[model samples]
Target: MNNSKNESVGCIVNECKFHSMGENYCTLNKIQVTKHETTAKDVQCTDCGSFVKR
Candidate 1:
């Protein structure tokens, strides 16, 4: 896992493979973000494409 202090990848999904245990953060070096809809109406329309099931 990356311990870089400069990175601020915060996450709450404990089921994700890249989610840091007990840290509420993502350990992936980078994440791919994508829109779930052609026209996003709210934050719920966004999705983290880098998510992998643990």
Candidate 2:
């Protein structure tokens, strides 16, 4: 696992493989934001497509 965190990417999902070790950030240089709903209502309607089970 890459413990190096991308300062620009803020994340709190500890279960994600790209999540920074011991920090609330993402290790990936970039991430995919996917929309699951027809209308962009709120945060819950979107997902981090780059997420991988740790």
Candidate 3:
């Protein structure tokens, strides 16, 4: 599916691998949006890469 014009979401990290360009994070840094398969839309965070989950 195509993301809506206003369907934008951001994260709190700047160096995240999932961080895409043109997206705005609520915080000052870049954040990655985690996708949840069973939920309504993207929701679950796969891995922080540099966190305990990694």
lDDT of each: 0.81, 0.91, 0.36
- Which digits, one per residue and each the tens of the lDDT, describe model 1 over residues 20-42? 88778888888889998999899
Best by lDDT: 2
Model 1 alpha-carbon drift over 4 Å, by segment: 1-7
Which candidate has the top score in TM-score?
2
Q: Name model 2 segments beyond 4 Å from true.
A: 1-3
**Total backbone clashes of candidate 2, pairs 3 or more residues apart or in separate chains:** 0
Model 3 steric clash pairs = 11-31, 13-30, 36-43
* Residue pairs with clashing backbones, model 1: none
Please provide, for model 3 over 1-54, each residue's C-alpha lDDT reduced to its tens digit, 9 standing for 90 to 100.
122222344444445433343463322133333544545443253533332111
Residue 17, candidate 3: alpha-carbon lDDT = 39
What TM-score would candidate 2 get against the native? 0.85
Candidate 1 TM-score, C-alpha based:
0.80
Query: How does candidate 1 score on lDDT?
Result: 0.81
